[model samples]
Target chain A: METLIFDLDAKPLREVNQFLHGDASGLNGKAFVIENPNGAHSIAVGLKSDIHVTVKGHAGYYAAGMNQIAKVTIEGSAGSGVAENMMSGMVHVKGFASNAAGATANGGLLVIDGDAGLRTAIALKGADVVVGGSVGSFSAFMAQAGNFVILGDAGEGLGDSIYEAKIFVRGKVKSLGADCEEKTMNPEDRKILADLLAKSGHAGVNPDSFKQYGSARTLYHFHVDNAGAY
Target chain B: MSEQQPKIPQTKPRFSATFDESTMSEIRRAAATGIYDIRGAGAKRKVPHFDDLLFLGASVSRYPLEGYREKCATDVVLGARFAKKPIHLKTPVTIAGMSFGSLSANAKEALGRGASAAGTSTTTGDGGMTQEERGHSSILVYQYLPSRYGMNPDDLRKADAIEVVIGQGAKPGGGGMLLGQKITKRVAKMRCLPEGIDQRSSCRHPDWTGPDDLEIKIAEIREITDWEKPIYVKIGATRPYFDVALAVKAGADVVVLDGMQGGTAATQEVFIEHVGIPILAAIRPAVQALQDLGMHRKVQLIVSGGIRNGADVAKALALGADAVAIGTAALIALGDNDPHLEEEYQKLGTTAGAYDDWHEGRDPAGITTQDPELMKRLDPVKAGHRLANYLAVMTMEAQVIARACGKSHLHNLEPEDLVALTLEASAMAKVPLAGTNWIPGVTGF
Candidate 1:
């Protein structure tokens, strides 16, 4: 496979983005290596085609934003909104992620290998998120539709105002947010978790260790009794 | 015996000013339902508006042109500040943003068709862009709201312009709410939420907190679109002076100012009535801010809220706005709350003119509902024609006014030709009262 190398210290971000955005069809299915990203903002944003991009170092805000039909792997820590609004692609962060790691993404898969910061997957639409470690407070806030798998502990206020999205956690939980509570894990849920773990490259882990959480379905209609929750 | 007693004149029954009938009814309804009343539309309470301003037709000092012979220009160009391609409109009136979830697909299509026919731009609201709108509209402006629902880069590039909405006039600092009943499968899918669930949009954007961050956000949008589309910053009329100045400093090509009289799909009644300033009080301050920065007319201003007729449009242009946008009026022109639907409206426990329960998704006129049966009642083609006809009439009416004012173009109608009827209106519009050279709160009256 043809490989392209971009050294951030040697070239300006605009120059690299210009080349990347410009007709990259010749390098279809090729690998792109980015060195010294060094927590820069908006690196590899709006990538539309199917290709492989590997960032050798830490990436900054909105890294791999609006990604579609591409595979992006970050080797080091990632800043806020990594893989935001992604559609039909995969983004794997090998290290810790900052806040709002997949905010408002409609379709895609985001895999975080380390601890995720606050509000991870806030307003996430259909992106499947798998966090390998613990997450901060307000994880999965207002999540609509998706599967969020947490392998470790969770902080407070998880899944506030949550909708149809399902949450599975293997470790301890701090507390649940409004309209969110623990749900019984059935065989179908176990099967879904097994598939998610397999897709996230954690197939060795047992699915029986996880607990499921989702919306209580009480806030679907307006009622005066629920005014305090609002 | 009762008929005989009624023949004599009796003293008129006195009513309580503090606890009126409407107030007592509201209390009773709240006690019975145990929830605050939620509805659509703008404030019903009267406020100072463009109706308070009158134009002085030319008599001697100003020469009036022949009504049919004079050529009055109504063309307006927007976003010439930085964009390579700016918007050119045949008329100064454009359609304001109303989301797909808040309105039916047919309604959006009709709006696109009408705006295209009128040679003006139509905007996408909170939910995001729809194919029906893009396919039919000749010029479409995409709104970037705090919710960021269904926002993607591809659509941003496809848009003719981008409007970053900081606030709307109906609820300045409040979040938007879509009740569960209106959240159909398609709306939910577009918004990335569960079907039939109440969706609450955040009041503030997650990324930027202030003007400094706003600059970066605008830059990012510019980069995404390759600096092609014009960016507009929209704010509710709270502190128009400061907001307009800040938006200009943040590198906006256009500023959209919405006043408190603006209509909303759904919001708390209290917030809608008592949150922001009137448009009459807002335009002068905004224009002053633009002048202070030496950007007046350079940075286009589009004002909305209570604009109804061509007279309102002419009055707005005189107040220094480049153009005017209409929301409630546009919906009305599309047959919303039409008298023909009076029988259906009565079944919902309200009259057609008084109906405002749009959030429930049971719109009989089919303009604001997602239900397939209700939506089918509206023919986009017919509705589009009606809207186009209404727009044509408004434009003609404005031209008549412009000719009477002896102005060759609608933009030439200045505040000097206007006179206010009340002290408050005179101060708000910064114009003198009729038959008097004195303007209240300015100099010696």
Candidate 2:
């Protein structure tokens, strides 16, 4: 495998991104190692190829944002909006992630080994997010369609104004938001959780330990009775 | 039988303030339908606009240029602040953002074609950029709205510029609403919403909270595009001074200020009429904000809403706007609400030139519907030619006014060359009254 090394301290963020931009489809089947990131923002943004990127140090805001068909691994903590609007790819964050981890993403798989900050999956359309640790408040706000799995406890007001997206949390929940409630996980959910756990490398966790949460569907249509909720 | 009847004094129609026909009809409709009336277009009520101000042609103090022989330049450059590639347009007037879903694909394509022909730019509205628009438009500005519907990074890269829409003038603080009938299968897929369901876009951005967050967001977008494209911040014409200042502070290369007369695909009528300030009132404050920041011309200001004809364009430019965008007028040029479609319009319980129910998707002009047959009726090539012709006429008309005012360039026409006809307009525009040397708030006692 061809490996490319980029030291952020030696080169500016734009220079490094320019190199990546120039390589577009040429980076396929190649690996890139970004060293001394120093919490640099917007690393690997708008990357579209099926390349493997490993950031050795912590990343600033929007790390690997708008990634498509690429495999990215963030070895340290990530700032806000990691993997935002990712179309089809896998982003593995080894440590904690700041707020809005996967905002408005369409399709992707994001696996966070540590805790995720508030509004983790806000407006997520169709992405599967698996968190090893707890997620902060307002997780999955206005989520339309996706599968969000949390291994640990969830913070307050989870899944507010949620739609068809399913939430499976293993630990205790603080509270649910408007029109969101706990639901029993049937066999189908267990199978999906099993698959997601295996993919996220958390197969040791018990699928049966999780509880499912979803939209109450009351606010789907406009009615005067539900006006207060809006 | 031939007795002369006493001719009673004819009682004139006395209009009521509280129980007017419009108010009564609105109450009746609301009571019957349980939901507020949602329609397209802008405020129907007349307000202060560019027409309130007129130019005094050069006679003795200033010398007029020869009409056809003299050069009257109209070129404008946008986003010179920080963008690597700024937009250079031949004309100061451009087509404003009107989405593919709200308008037909044909209409969007027509706008792109017309703008491209005129050497200007067209913009993508609430929905994302369509292939037809991208292909036809030589320079296209992609809007980053609060809804985030159809927002994708690839398109952001493809765009010549990015406009972060904070608020629309028609409904300043309100969100966008697309009714069930307009959301076709394609639109549904693009927006990630259910088919045939009412789609209400959120007014607030999911990621950011306030101005501070907006700064971060702008930085992020700049990073996404690698600072190759210019970033514009569009605000509704309310609190223009503060909003423009904040946008410039947030690292915007351009600012788009839209007045209440700006049109929308679907919005509450109450919000449209009572929400925002007029374009005439908004331009000066926005320009002042830029001037205060010491970046007036550095960061281009584009004003929209009720901009029609050459005089309106010249007035806006004289008030310190670098460019003026057109939405409602553009649609009209594209054959929306044409009188020739009177029969079809009447069948929809509305008449031509008064049809505002664009959300109903029964437009006879085939400009604002997703219905396949109706959409097919609008030929992009023909409509594009018509729009180009209209733009040409507007440009020539502005040239005539500029020549008469002794200004060689449109930007050379300053506030000193204009005078307001009414006190309200004089106060709002900060220009002298027509027959007096006094401005209402400035020199007048």
Q: Which candidate comes out best when scored by lDDT? A: 2
TM-score of each: 0.92, 0.95
lDDT of each: 0.88, 0.89
lDDT of 1 by residue, B206-244 (tens): 554689768767766765665678899989999999999
Among all windows of 10 consecutive residues in model 2 chain B, the one with the lowest summed lDDT is B436-445
Q: Model 1 chain A, poorest ten-residue lDDT window?
A: A18-27
* Number of the top TM-score candidate: 2
Where model 2 places Cα greater than 4 Å from the true spot, the runs are A181-188, B1-13
The per-model DockQ list reads 0.44, 0.55
Candidate 1's C-alpha runs over 4 A off are A6-15, A35-38, A56-58, A198-206, B1-11, B57-70, B206-208
